[model samples]
Structures are given as C-alpha cells and as structure tokens.
Target: MASFEVKGGNKLNGTIVPQGAKNEALQIISAVLLTAEEVTVSNIPDILDVNLLIELLEDMGVKVSRPSRDTCIFKADAVDADYLASEAFRNKGGKLRGSVMVAGPMLARFKKAFIPKPGGDKIGRRRLDTHIIGFEKLGAQFDYHDEEGFFQLSSPRLKGTFMLLDEPSVTGTANIVMAATLAEGTTTIYNAACEPYVQQLCKMLNSMGARISGIGSNLLTIEGVTALGGTSHRMLPDMIEVGSFIGMAAMTQSEITIKGAGVEHLGVIPDKFRQLGIQLEIRGDDIYIPAQEKYEITTFLDGSVLTVYDHPWPGFTPDLLSIMLVVATQAVGSVLIHQKMFESRLFFVDKLLDMGAQIILCDPHRATVIGLGRKHKLRGITMSSPDIRAGQALLIAALSAEGTSIIQNIEQIDRGYQYIDERLRQLGAEIRRL
Candidate 1:
C-alpha cells in the first residue's frame, strides 16, 4: 500500500527516455520457451509486471541471466513441467495476465500446460475465449475446472489449421502464433491482431527459425519448424509511455522532450494529442512539447463535437484514452471520450470530478469532459489508483493541480511504469514516494 505525496503546481523541463514496451516484453519473453537455445533480449522495462513475469520464468527452471540493467539472456532448455501444476505456480501465475502466454509455448514444446485464471487490471472482463478457441483449432484439447479455478490443456502433437478470430486480441494472437510455429503444418490466421506488440513477436519468432509472413498485416501465415534457435531482440520504445508523457506535458504546461520515442511506430498517437490542440514538434527521433497557457480542442470538419474513440490497429489505442480524458480537463473545448474496448475504464472520472474537473459520465463506456480553459486550476485531493492507466492519469492531474495531493496504491502505477517518480523528478517534478 505504498503512496505518493505529489506537490502540484510545478512545471517540468528536461529530456526523458521512454522505457521498453510492456506489452511487447510479455510476448517476446514468453516466446523464449519455444526454443532451447539462449535468447538475449534487450531494452526490457524494469517494471513490476515484467519483473513478475521474469520471476515466474525463473521459478519454472528457465535459466535467466541479466548482463545489464535492461537486458536478459534466457535459456529455457530445462523448464520444469511439474512446476506449472504446483500451487505456487497457480498463485504466482494467476496474479499476472501475461502468464497466460506461457501456456502456448509449454503446450507446443512439452505437449501440456496449466493455465490459471489470470488477473491484472480490474477494469472489466478480459475473457480468454480467443486464446482457448485458437488453441482448440490447433489440435489441442482443454478442460476448465471451476473448483480449482484453472484450465488444463494438453496436446500430443499440434497440427496447424486456419482460424478466423472473433476478435483481434493481442495476447490471444501472440499465443496462437507461438503455438503454430511448432505445429506439423502451416497455419493461417485471419482477422488477427496486428498491433506493434504482435508484430514484434512475429518478427522475433521469424528470427528464431520460424517462418512467419505478413509482419504488419491483419493476416498471418506461420510455417511450422522442427525446432527454433536462439536470437537477440530489442523491444521498441513504449508508445503508451510516450503518450502519457505528451499528456503530462500538456496538463502541467511543461517543456519536455521525449528521447527516442520510436516516432515511426507511434501511428495516430501524436495526431490524437494534436486533436486536443496540444502542440508537439518532431525533432528527429525526439518529441519536443512546448509549454503553453492553454490548448484548444479541435472540432470535426462539419463543426460537430469531436469524439475520440478506441479502435483496432492503425486507429487510436484504448490504453491512452485515460490520458486523453485527463488532458482535456484544461483544454479550450469539450470532447467525448469513448472507451470502446473496456467497459469500466471510464469509471475513474469520479476522481477527476472530485479534483474540480467539469465532467459528465455518460455511461460505463463514455465520458464527456468540459475543459475549464485553465481559468481555474484544479485543486489537489487524496485518491487511490484503480488501474495502471488511470493511476498515471491521476498523477498527471495531481502534478497540475494547485496543492499537495496524496496518491495511494501506487503499486498499480509501478506495474507498467518503470521508475516513474525518479524520472519525473529529473524533469523538475515535485513527487515523493511515501
């Protein structure tokens, strides 16, 4: 129950580097189990969720060594099969949503896997239907035990087949792709998630001797290989962190530069912030955001109210919607934030309302925020983090508020963000971990 004592009303000014992508780290690290050779992964984020995933691997008998702070060399040659069925595994694996990814590599290599009902955010129902159905299509059988709260999956040998996913789930697609790599025949996946994280996994698999095509497309083709070999992979800069920093700069009226933000991979993210009238310049690979007294939200071409909604890849990501909602509080106009992916993600608006932001919670999926135009500064208040994204949004709000603010349950923030308070302090922010 760690808390943060954030003193508001200070503008930040410095350059900060974004950490490795958390979503990609989960997939790439899980893919290591597909091969017995050593895989060297670089630029991993030193975050709570990622560290937990790494510890889970170590407990499963994967030999892991860190040559540097941001790199890990993993050898999964001696993975313990019995450990996956132990109670210790259930308790540790169930706490992390990323643990479900190991099931694919396990079932592919060892012919069996135990998947506990995974948990992470409390935002809404994150169903495993996509993962289960995809695995069944690949000649795997599974049984769910309601009493034990786990799914037992086994397959003597995997035979690849075609699957048109009901939804393009990122984790589901990554899981299925890893399984297909070791199957007997070629597998074709239609309507697959083409997020950068999924694409990175596919690329890393290809480098490990798996034949995968359609790197950045909705359709993927995987040609089964007898065995995979080791390779090195470097994660892309975390786009979520980039978007969060952009929002923080706007809300706090700070002059900050984000170093090596992977601008090319950040599709529609910078434009989405620009829609809120936040000005940012692309200086090579760095994003420079200038301080401003006020930023105005833009309207549609038809002069209609601007509505920002989440969609699949090439569209705006749903994870950053919380940051967008928080940034709009001090903008010059109103905007509707529609979180189409998750139902309960918008529930954090109550905290903003308490902070003196003019917001109307339309429903569980949508919120309308009326910008105060910065005429009245937001006042600090005590709050608890509900989830990772919402916690970062609240921290930004607290940094821009008038007085001191206390944020409890900062473990939620630590889950995705690496050394957030330390990095913020480098940018002249007044934040202390309590």
Candidate 2:
C-alpha cells in the first residue's frame, strides 16, 4: 500500500553494489532445514519475501541468529512437525511462492511436508506439477485437501530413481534435488535446471556431504547421503539488479558503476543489453556505464527489426525483459520484445504507452517498441506496478521522464530490491517513498 513519488530528469552518478541474489537466497535458506547442525548463510538479502520465509522457519522452532545484517545462522535441531499441519503455515506460506520450496527438505527429513496454495506474480500459469511429480517419482505420496487448499506429502523413506522433467523449472529442480539428497539410492535427473542459483545450491549441499555431480549441466546425478552437516555459503550478487542498473543508467543518461556485480555469473545479460546498443565497460568485477545521448538498436545483416526474447538458462532471462522493454523505448531504433515464458508480463506496456512511448502490444506475450530515440522527452504519468520487474521498469521510466510520476503498489518492488528508494537516492535519484 505504499507509493513512490519520483521527480524525473536526474542524471545519477556514483557506485552502487548489487544486493545478494534473491532467488538463490530462497533456495538456500529453505535447504537449511535439511540439517540439524548450524548452517550459516552470508550475503542474505534483507527483503520482505526472505524475511517472511525466515520468520516462518523460526515459528517452526528453528533456532535463528543473525550475526550481521546480511548473515544468518540456522540450526534446526528441534522443529515442530505438528505445526506443519496447522493453519498458520497455510496462511503464511500462501503469501510467497518461495514458501513452497520448504516442502522438499521437510519431506526429506521429517517424512512429511505440507504447503498451502503458494502465491506469486500473475504473469502466467506457473504450475507445481514439476515439483509434485518429481517428489512422487522419488517415492513420496501426494494428497490434496480440497477444503483446506493445501498439499500434503509424506514418505516413509524416499527411494531415488531416474526421471526426465518436462521442463527445466528452477524451483522444481531445487526441490527435487534437496529431497533426493537423503533418499535411499541414486537419483538421476535429466532436463534439470542448471541456473547459477541451482548450481550454488548443489555446491552448498555437497559441502554438507550430499554427493551430486554435473553441477553446471542440465543433467544431475545425486547419491543420497544418510545426513547432511553444517556448512557456510556466500550468495552471488543479484544479476537481475545489475541488468536493471544498466538499463537505468542508459535511460537516465547516467554515469554509474556497479561494484561486485559478479559479472562472471551474469549469463547473457550484458550481451543482451549490448544488443540494444548500450556501451558497457567491465573493470575487474564491476560494470561501468557511461552517459549516452542516444544509442541505436542493432538489427540483423538483412536489416530485419531486432528481436529480444527470453528462454531457459544460458538464454536471456525473462525477468529482465521488462527493463529491456522500457529501455528500448529510449533507444534510437525499433525492437520486438518477446516474453515467451510469461504470457501476461507484456501487459505492462499499457503503462509505458501512457508515458508517451510508442509501443504496440502484439499479444499476451509479445510487444513491438519503436524507440523515440531521444527525439522527444517522455512525459510522466501515474501508474501502478503489477509485478516485481514491471515495478522496477516503471521506476526507471520515471527517472528518465520529463515530470513527476507517482507509482503505487510498491510492495511488489520491495519484495525483491532492498531499500530501493533509499539506495536510488544515494545515487542522486530524486525518489521518495510515501
């Protein structure tokens, strides 16, 4: 229920550090329940979703301690299994989609897991068939309570096997991997999600004695261990935030440096922005973007209109397409944005169109943006953020527009970014939270 009042036309400067990866934190934090020993996680983002997950763990009697603002130690020596069946978990877990991940580790350890209908962005239909089917493949019995709207999963002892996933669902892969870690035999997963987040989770689990191979590929092999021990892990920097900063600097004509951006792990993000004709200098582990009056989009050799689309890992991420679409509005040439993963993500173009950007919404999943090319400045207008990435896109547009813009429903942005308005203000942006 908060709003951001943004005064446009500010050229931001200075260095900003990317926060810890939010997606990675969700998977790793939930894995902490797999061990009774003290597991310490560093570089944890202080965002609403992460904090809510931590609070849920604490409610189940997991001993939680924070040594620093971005570090936490979890010891799940005495968790209350009965509480899993309570209505509190249903109400709380239903608020965040990441909450569903706890099921795998819980079932792996306690022989039972329950999760309410998880909630998240309405971008498209994100089905849980991958996670549930993977669990069932590994010897877990699944049941649904129609009245309660919660899934109940139980397994006396999980027995590992071979299976091929329908798709490389990231959360689904993490859940299955965690569950198979303590299963009785060997597990081979084909078409598994091999994103950096999933790789880090596997590495972290291996450090605690889980035997997993094929860390960076779509196929993974796991040999279930009797138990996992304590381990310390540091999360990678948020690459999506790094991409957002790149778009922000280009749109606002700012000279900014993003420090410790973990550039090595940012697969396809930099090149995708470069395709939009933005210049980026890589200095050590930092990304430096200089002010530009105009940047032209690149097309194919035959002069076909450039198209930027998203795919699975090692491909352009769908999360950054919103920022990419907004940045394209200010570029010198035209580009078609195809958000193949989420059907409803492109609907946010209506808000951008109201800001004087020339865009054609082709369908539920695609749009064609004709960049104004700095020919005229965009006029700000009131808008509401429908999701996390779109919220950041609106903020970027407001920073580059000609007048003040008021954005409501900022809670979606807060779920991912940490103190976004305050951090932007430090970088010379004229933004205030109300």
Query: What RMSD does each model have against the real structure?
Result: 0.6, 0.7
lDDT agreement of model 1 with the native = 0.95
Per-residue CA lDDT of model 2 for 305-407, tens digit only, reads 9999998899888999999999999999999999998888988888888899999999998899999998888888999999999999999999999999999
Which pairs clash inside model 1? none
**Model 2: clashing residue pairs?**
none
| Cα lDDT of model 1 by residue, 1-434, tens digit | 79999999999999999999999999999999998999999999999999999999999999999988799999999999889888899999999999999999998999999899978999999999999999999999999988879999999999989999999999999999999999999999999999999989998999999999988999999999899999999999999999999999999999999999999999999999999999999999999999988999999999998999999998899999999999999999999999999999999889999999999999999999999999988999999999999999999999999999999999999999999999999999999999
Q: Which regions of candidate 1 deviate over 4 angstroms? A: none
lDDT of 1 at 147: 85
